[model samples]
Target: MTPDLFGRHRAVLPDWLALYYEDPLEITHGEGRHVWDAAGNKYLDFFGGILTTMTAHALPEVAKAVGEQAGRILHSSTLYLNRPMVELAERVACLSGIPDARVFFTTSGTEANDTALLLATAYRRSNTILAMRNSYHGRSFSAVGVTGNRGWSPTSLSPLQTLYVHGGVRTRGPYAHLGDREFTDACVDDLKDLLGHTRAPAALIAEPVQGVGGFTSPPDGLYAAFREVLHERGILWIADEVQTGWGRTGEHFWGWQAHGQNGPPDIVTFAKGIGNGMSVGGVVARAEIMNCLDANSISTFGGTQVTMAAGLANLAYLLEHDLQGNARRVGGLLLERLRSVAARVPHVREVRGRGLMIGVELTRPGTDEAAPEAASAVLEEARAGGLLIGKGGGHDTSALRIAPPMSLTVAEAEEGAAILERALRSV
Candidate 1:
């Protein structure tokens, strides 16, 4: 019996709130890398709720931490001395690689980015922000302002004067045809030129791997090169590591390390996987920038004891088990397997990403034209074959995203790859 819940959902929820699939799925429960629909259909979850579930679903440590914290205190505002928050902050600061790093926790990535913008603008005394093309920061007014993707940015009204930068998406821009070194030089030249025209900007923000832009990234050390120019101009570099943090990229715990020649970013914002599903977002910055705001500020719900408890427990588990190493090993296997599968499919234009954060861009066969329809078809087909994935791209949602839990096993990777191959073939 088909439920009328979908009809009710449409009636109550705002239409603009995007849902996947023509028939949106209702996940009843999840365990490990798999989830069950309300109707009892089991599927291997590849996207892992946009890579928020860094570890496996229903991990015992996280569950115990949340459960224990709830038994004691659900939440205490920032006014209270929150032990768990302090502990987690210390850990994040140590991990952040920023000198004299201070941590400010928020409930979501959007709020974290908003706080970062606040600190950067206040410190530099400039409202001008530079962001990468095809980047999606968040939904807040200020975050959306720096977002360079037209499809995601809903309004032109912004308090900040934003300049869109190049090199975030290296696959299909005017400089795409250039070699890695050449592309780096070209993008650097472009940035210098853009900066010459604009007033002094507060900061330049970028994602090491653009999540919603279909896992695209510039050549290694591109940001390092840009950092050199920005440093000379006294502009801060803010790395939005919401998706790329926590060894998701395998080689680096933090995404900025790929461009670490410039040392740590002036400010870094992270969310999504740190809490392993708990709503934990935070910003890490040097003492100077963090202390710029003179007025009193506090996040009532930010750094709540319960969420902090969850974060501490989760981080402990991730490090103890060496999930970062697991990500590197298994992610390498998965990436190689995906490439093999994509090589056989003409519709698969490019397979890209680091670690489990992978994307297979779809295109009209033998052409560069994006094939969002083919991507959608592959998604539906994958779901039918008991596999769950995600789709995203700057060009009309033309890339299939695959990011399973960090604890993914060899057999599971092979299983998901087979299912994805079948789906691509069907499409």
Candidate 2:
């Protein structure tokens, strides 16, 4: 009754599905740092499924856990209690350092953020929420409403209650050409001015590292200072770790941790690697603040049996294997190699980000305008050379983001860097 796996169908895949993938590669299967297409040609995954793969693809332990959980149980109604769900909550809370905290789980980053928005607005009894410019929360109505990127603004603007404000940018090494201390101060001042002009904000959401804003790491003392400003105005600080969480940044378990003493976020949202490719996302809220939400607020698919099993296994694999330490060491080596290559290319403007979350910015030989064509050419060249990476920033100009799995080895990192360097030269 079923068609052959390789059999052609009269109906082709929907164009909407094609819209999600900008690249031409058709993935069939994946393993550690490698993906294969229908032709069975392998490509090294430097992008790590857009940084969602923390333990690498088809991780044996993670797969084993999922298999075992599938054999045992898969889903349950929210009205009933489940062991995997309960244990996952406890582990996530403990690791996140939110004591006695309540967790609301979802299936994606946007859903998690949307839930947070609902809870914040309902609990705080405020219709206004302030988000940083150049931010990207998600595509859903409420979550997209909070996003501040210009490209997404047209689709996001509506009767949705939200306010967009620019956050502190980066302008130095490891994070360059972004807003600095002066910018953060100005942002705070702007927020104060906004508060005076409009209603008190319910929440102030930001990415500790602005992943979509060209990997902009806020200036030193920025988050701590922002925390103070938000607290003074009785607004909660919501750290959107959708792209920066789950130890991808290395040296720290979460991106907010890199903010030093000033970056302790009040509420943190996480997805991507938490389930190691399973459908799962969650929020770890400060115990006191989380209590503001009423019991009526709940999600149906939150902490499904299979998803929790996968999350627990993924966290275990990361911790037991010291993936974070590996990322820190290998990422440093890779960055040094990139810097060495940049020294040869006059067009390479900067290299930024910490650990595995890195970005390479290319520019004109003597001007600030980026050569997007050159960057794209280099990307395609790298793909031809067997390295799969990603491009970011609004113009698609300079910023090339590289966020491989934490399990990537020193040797693999070197190989990826070497290929990237060669690709740059070819372009």
Candidate 3:
């Protein structure tokens, strides 16, 4: 049955839609931090469907809210007054640090970022954008233009002229050897030099933590320094928090807080885990920027009643249960365990990240070359050991990604880490 379904998927889906492992496993159902495959094999879900099942799988609060909303209405266009939509918007606006904040909903991170680009360009009246090296915003045309990761970026042609900036990855690049303060100063100087050479840029969009770039991140306060420079020139700052928002980083509610010395970003885009599996994405910004569009625009299914309901419930549960605290406690232990294991593994290049968004980068023994094959082998071996994980990186995709649901328990983390250690050693 699995083979037949896989064949059907290949025949219908786009070739670029990649799947994990040499033989893909079809997940039948999930509960808590575990999932059952079609063949009824259960495995610990460490990746949490690419970090979308944020709170948990089949969370009662979210599921109940979705069911209740669906019974009333599945969708209502943005033209109408949607109670759930308005409620969710209010919550998002208040949570967003922007003064006089406004919210615009989208169906995915791609659309949210596209909307952010539109707002930034319209408000700043420029087509130029500054994005970080080894960064990934999304898959939309405008988002792709700003993406610095070549593996995810498929085309060079774009409507906006994008300038790639340095300092997203702390362990690589020309400035990797510098101390944090020195590195921030060098990057700031480079940004100033780049601005001198080009036309005024619309905005600088960056992920506080580069999610798809193997959970790479610059030193804290780096973006704050960049913000000061951009603010002086009246250029906006957009934080792509699609993967780093909602307290996933342990120490902060948003990844931007790590660089909060200059306050929040001008525009913030978020998605992935907000709805706990339901499709919900949005951009939050100051009212002036959010209202910069001269013409009216509406999303057909962006703020559908059901999705909004799910988001509200999921968010409430996340806050009430203090899943962020759980992530910090469990994730810290997991990170320590993984680092201890990686210390003995020659192929383990680096183990880094905060909270549940940890990454273990693989490289050829005694060399800087990315060991993608080793990553793949570890992934397969981990699955065989009754654990599921993820892999991502730059063009080579040689890093193991382990982002479990935020509600992950200490026991679960220990179990998953043990399995992962065995997998890494076996590979």
Candidate 3 local Cα displacement, residue 35, angstroms: 0.7
Give the per-residue lDDT of model 1 (tens digit) for 1-427: 1459888887899988998888889998899999999889999999988889999899889999999999999887988899999999999999999999999999999899999999999999999999999999999999999998878999999999999999998889999999999999999999999999999999999999999999999999999999999999999999999999999889999989999997989999999998888999999999999999999999899889888988998889889988888888999999999999999999999999888889999999999999999999999999999999998899989999999999999999999999999999997
lDDT of 2 at 154: 48
Q: In model 1, what are the clashing residue pairs, if there are any?
A: none
Against the reference, the lDDT scores of all candidates come to: 0.93, 0.77, 0.93
- Determine which window of 10 residues in candidate 1 has minimal summed lDDT: 1-10
Candidate 1 positional error at 92, Å: 0.2
- Which residue pairs collide, candidate 2? 169-178, 169-179, 170-178, 170-179, 171-177
lDDT of 2 by residue, 290-320 (tens): 7786667556788889999999999888889
Q: Candidate 3 clashing pairs?
A: none
